[model samples]
Target: MNVLHLDTSALGTYSISRQLTAAIVGQLQRDGVASSVSYRDLAAEPLPHWLPNPDPASDNALRDEAVLQQFVDADIVVLGAPMYNFTITTQLKSWLDRVLVAGRTFRYGPNGPEGLAGGKRVIIASSRGGKYSGGPAAAMDFQEPYLRTVLGFIGITDIEFVRAEGVAMGDEAKQAALQAAHATIGELALRKAA
Candidate 1:
């Protein structure tokens, strides 16, 4: 099976989301599930913001085709999405614009919208600087909710999230959150086995 791993954190080595995504991909590899893995660091190789009317011959068009193809072809998708200010990174959003095509990922039926990109499992390694799962900041969290809505819109309902929150609180908090995320990843493996 093909695993598409996308990392969007700008911090590189210091990014907890990146670490978690790597571990998740490693676990998949060790489980003998992923026959091949494709890695894309969106932060380093950012796709240009998609234009409403794109030039078919432009470089961005070629890149968009390749990006969309990767998403459509992958059996599994792992995303390292660190909350930037409250939502996803612009780079990741740009990538989404390419993949969430009208006749590709979704379609507008007579009743409403229907998603075409189902059956694939998606795991998101989400990292946040503060505690947004609860507290007053919870209402302000647009990252996870937005991702869930958008991915669901594309028919990706078999989704899992490994979150490392309150990382910026302190060293202890960071470690604890990371440990929790790792535990979640382990549980995901068990679920996959079942």
Candidate 2:
């Protein structure tokens, strides 16, 4: 099975989300599902927000073909994202723009909208600087909600999220968030066994 790991952390080495995603991927690999992972780092190799001659930059094509193909071709997808000012990174958004094709991944159904590509699971590893999960600021979190909509639109409805919030408050908050992230990863690891 193919697992696509998309990491969008602006801070390369200091991103808690990226660390959690790595843990998740490692756990998935231990399950012995014949898994293969595709890594996409948006900051280092950003997806084109607007294509320059429809070129697929960094092998992404700045279009849906390669990006959607990654999901359409994979059994699972793991997104590592960091909240920037209450929203996700622009680089990740660019990647989404490439994958949410109108006809290929979705269609104009009689009901309204329906996901075409089913059976794949997506796990989002998100990090926020402040205490926002289920808080009054939670509604302001456009990262997770927006990702849910965009990925859901293109036939990927089954999703699980591992969020690390309150990282920027202080060292204590960051440590707490990291601990929570690890706990979530362990649970996912157990789930993989089941």
Leading candidate by lDDT? 1
| Residue 193 in candidate 2, Cα distance off native in Å | 1.0
Position 86, candidate 2: lDDT: 75
Q: Write the per-residue lDDT of candidate 1 for residues 1-194, one digit (tens) a residue.
A: 89999999999899999999999999999998899999999999888777864587777677788899999999999999899989998888988999899999999999899999999899999999999987799898999999989999999998889999999999999999999999999999898888
Find the candidate with the highest TM-score and give its number.
1
Per-residue lDDT of 85 in model 1:
88
Please report how far candidate 1 places residue 94 from its true position, in Å.
Answer: 0.9
Off by over 4 Å in 1: 52-54
Q: lDDT score, residue 29, model 2?
A: 86
TM-score on alpha carbons, each prediction: 0.96, 0.90
Lowest summed lDDT window (length 10), candidate 2: 55-64
